[model samples]
Target: MSRFFVNVYSIWAAFWFVFTFLLIFPFQFIFLQKEAWKPMAHRCNRVWAHLFFPLVGMPIRVRYEAGKPDPNQAYVFAANHFSYLDVASMMLIVDTYFAFLGKDVLKKAPLFGYMFSKLHIQVDRNDPKSRSKSLQRSYRALESGRSMVIYPEGGIRTSNPPQMHPSFKDGAFRMAIREQVPLIPISLLNNYQLLPDKKNMRLYPGSVKAVIHKPIETKGMTEADVENLRQQVFDIIQKTLDEYTANPKAHQNEFKRLTVI
Candidate 1:
């Protein structure tokens, strides 16, 4: 709770994070070498997260408002961005193979950067050319029947906790419509509280909770529907966050415990 303890715990968590990644780096490197083996490299990421989170005392739990998703189907997943921990927490959310559409800055992170650049799609949000190229890559991935995880807020630009950034970008919605895939909305209920986007980057150990809403069907939808669909997903996640902020305990027992160990 104190600043000193928060710093210490964060440092400890960071240590385990880097250590676990090092253990799996060789396998990931090999898996990333061939296009056919990229999915295996993503799974290695999940393994690393499972090892790091528990060691740092963060257990992940999920509750589905709708039924669980079918692993065989491809989907576009959109969730609010609030903390660095959200990246790792995603490995716990979707069980099947998927790639993340994250900021290009992640491509610069030490060992993880190389793996991410090869295994996932990265975009420079500020550059029109880069965004267009990333969207093309995402389209190709969807066409190949692979799912994608995108933070519709673009990045963690929110200064407020529990409250999401007012605008949700249309990229996720457009991709879902164009690909004729289901768009899944997720609410990361408590990540910002556990580990916020701040300069100091302090972290606390606790149960990370997420709510996966029912998939919004995009079949037969046109480009004209992108705005409505984006707003619809935003409202779903924002409403869930409001409810959790009002009564966090009401949703705790509602979630089925997901075993990470």
Candidate 2:
């Protein structure tokens, strides 16, 4: 818990992360062009996250409140983004043939950036042309039977740390509505504590707890229902966060909920 310990851990984490990247990314990059999407789409992400968690000393546990996601089905997952570690945490949940609808800027990040540019849907939000291309790419990914993960908040909207952003953007919901994919809202309860968005970085060894909520159906949803569906997903994720924050111990165990929204 000391600053010195956290500093020491960060140094170790950086070395291990780069080491793991060197070990895994080359094959992932090669397969992105050479193999089918399902075979290579999430291979590096899953492997990198599995390696990153231990080096950072965080045991990220994914609890299925509804049940384990169906590998055979595709989904549009919208999760709360509150920390630098959120995306890494997300990689743990997306176990099936999956790709992320992530920011275009992420593709510039060193070795992993090449994977982002090639395998995932990268959106430059400021450019209308880029957004259109990204949307089309997302639709194609979904239609091809590969699941996709999207942060509906549009890249860390809440500047004041861990609270849910005031409102959700509709690109992710709109994609689900138009493409008719099931929407799953993910609750990343403690990712912020692991790595906050602050000037002074404090990386530490901690548990990354998360909830895999039931997939909210968007089968009959239209453009008009985007707000309603977005609100519903936001509420589901926010409420779980509130519960976990109020009594961390009460919600530690893996949960199972029979209800589907």
Candidate 3:
């Protein structure tokens, strides 16, 4: 499909998905039992992903270093974010129970806003207090055995395509070490390829690819080791991305459809 058609379909599908979710899920969400929302919300999100990806004509594909992560264990999934699709497509790969530490503006999105407030942890970067609160909430979530999805680069701030921003925020790594959870380096390799972070709501005809790198165990680590841990994940993902840039064809899939529970 052409770029024009892809953009048109994406805009149409996004609004439509939000409208449908508003009608069906908002009532349940408003009264969602706080402690019981994980499984309920995760099921709803998977349904949304199944509907949107096919509706927008974008196929999903995944490349896991190991087959997949154990659903029973909690993890801190750190990925590079370069496209709006990064968050949405995460549902296709992460089948385990997890919530994301996302930007505060995510709550302003139509139907997702309500769900984000109830199900995910949101942080306001400008406010030190808010960031502190979100970090506390994230630590509690990890302690309670719920995994988290965090972007190490913070957001899609890189000036150059496919290259990570020069540095990363310390929040994700800090919590991982303090909580002693395995941090999984996730590389959303195809998000920028399928949709560049440009001014327009643009898309392209392509398959999605995410590399779930081997988990880095943070046992017996402290705040002093945060940057070293951050750099370790950054190097692994950036190296895989650089290899993809050198040879994209090897990663292409003709009929492989990624499955997530």
Please name the candidate that would achieve the greatest TM-score relative to the true structure.
1
Best-matching candidate per lDDT? 1
lDDT of 1 by residue, 90-201 (tens): 9978877898998989889898899999999999999999999999999999999899999999898788878899998899999999999999999999999898887777
Q: Write down the TM-score for model 1.
A: 0.97
1 versus 2: better lDDT goes to: 1
Off by over 4 Å in 3: 1-4, 19-33, 251-256, 259-261
User: Candidate 1, residue 26: CA error in Å?
Assistant: 0.7
Q: List the residue pairs that clash in candidate 3.
A: none
- Using lDDT, rank the candidates from best to worst: 1, 3, 2
Off by over 4 Å in 2: 35-38, 255-261
lDDT of 3 by residue, 1-261 (tens): 676777676687668667656654754474455666557777777777787777666777777777689888889999998898898889877878898999999899766787777788999999999999999999999988899999978889997868889798888899899999999998888789777898875667667887888888999999899989988988998998888888877756522466431
- In candidate 1, stretches whose alpha carbon ends up further than 4 angstroms from where it belongs are none
Listed in order, each prediction's TM-score against the native is: 0.97, 0.93, 0.90
Residue 161 in candidate 2, Cα distance off native in Å:
3.6
> How well does candidate 2 score on lDDT at residue 181?
86
Residue 180, candidate 3: C-alpha displacement in angstroms? 0.8
* Tens digit of per-residue lDDT, candidate 2, span 142-249: 898888888888988887655788788888899888989898889888878878777887777777778888888889889999989988998898888888888988
Clash-forming residue pairs, model 2: none
Local distance difference test scores for all models? 0.90, 0.80, 0.82
| RMSD in angstroms between candidate 1 and the native structure over all alpha carbons | 1.1
